[model samples]
Target: MMGQPPYSRTTIDELLRLIERAGLFERQPMVERKIMHYSSLQTILLVGEGNFSFSSALATAFESAENIVASSIDSEDKVLRVYNTARSSIENLESRKALVLYEVDATRLHEIEELSTRIFDRVVFNLPHAGYFPGGECSKEAIKKNSELLSMFLESATKLLSLDGEIHVTNKVGPPYKKWNLEGAAENYGLYLKESVSFQKADYPGYMNKRGSGAKINRTFRLGECETYMFSAV
Candidate 1:
């Protein structure tokens, strides 16, 4: 099903304030509550979650024991070589009662039988790169490939999001990444930006950066400068 129109809107400052309140950042800006509260009924999905690298975020989210699902395009074999954890990482996620699926394409999420019937309140993707190494050149082809990947993911994710639900993607802010025009891509799917906030690596205790596709490859992310973007159906 297509997503409903977007409603809520937020500025960068307001977004940062909200994320800070959620205890998602390394240092709390000005917390007025113990934690941003949510019901156990909320559902979350993480696409392109390699090796459970952002496992800490998973842990925090798992605290609610809500309907949490994590998908990665890479197979278990690839995860082992790239993430160096074997199946243990994913096993850990499953142990926490998370729905872990491999060979699951973010763009094809609606095709899964177990997931097709479900709707999530929050969906997240980090450094949504097709397959680029750090300090790499940004060719026109590379940019196009990245955009296409994002376009596909947004198109599919929106269909699985509940009304008022949001899709959050965290990404670096330069070179090839900036050219992706994530906001514009979401807009193409009738989604609008609701918030944008700074992201800190140390904020999530169990988080790890992308390990690329091979053991020899380097990480594809920048810790402090990245920003978290939330888009809602519109």
Candidate 2:
């Protein structure tokens, strides 16, 4: 049986916001940093972008997105229809010469001739979820399915990595997500966790976290506590 979809209940981010409003949530102080992990000097490939705003933001930050390739699993028509900001974001990337692709599946990236022939310094998948499935997002089946997606992605991504290249996945930290056990899954695919860092949305000025699937596909989600897991070939 299909499980309850995400956002059907109070999300952790929403709960945290309520706590903050009540003067009880201890929030971490935001730190200012000059250098972030991503750079225009390195070849970057972004997969599963809902609306491509994140890609556009990166391009703006670097002042050039020539070294970046952004892709979405959804078709151009769907993206253009679902995301109100999609047109402008795609235009921004294209204007900056950033390659924008549609119908790119993260799990089978190695099969794409366009991506297979090239190598990238960084292959990024931000907040990857397998979407709604049987038993829902919190079920063990959901965790296993999501883990399989990550493992397959890691296997495929390894083929397109340059020497010393890395694969990055930023996801919410807790509950069924934590149960995904991505670090362990990465090891099965010959990847080792290089580093895990807190994911601060403020780091990317125009980036917004969208549901990316189902009825809430066009809406943004509350990102409570998230982390970026960096992995490289072992």
Q: Which one is best on TM-score?
A: 2
Off by over 4 Å in 1: 1-41, 64-66, 86-88, 133-137, 218-221
Candidate 1's error at 191, in angstroms? Answer: 0.6
| Candidate with the greatest lDDT versus the true structure | 2
List, residue by residue over 1-234, the lDDT tens digit for candidate 2: 998776735686788789899859876643322237987678899999989988888988877788899999999999999999999999999999999999999999989878988999999999998887757898887888898888888888988999899999999998979888889888987888999999998888888888888888889989999999999984
Extract clashing residue pairs from model 1. Answer: 5-233, 5-234, 6-233, 6-234, 56-206
Query: What's the count of clashing pairs in each model shown?
Result: 5, 0
Off by over 4 Å in 2: 1-35
Local distance difference test, each candidate:
0.74, 0.88
Candidate 1, overall lDDT? 0.74
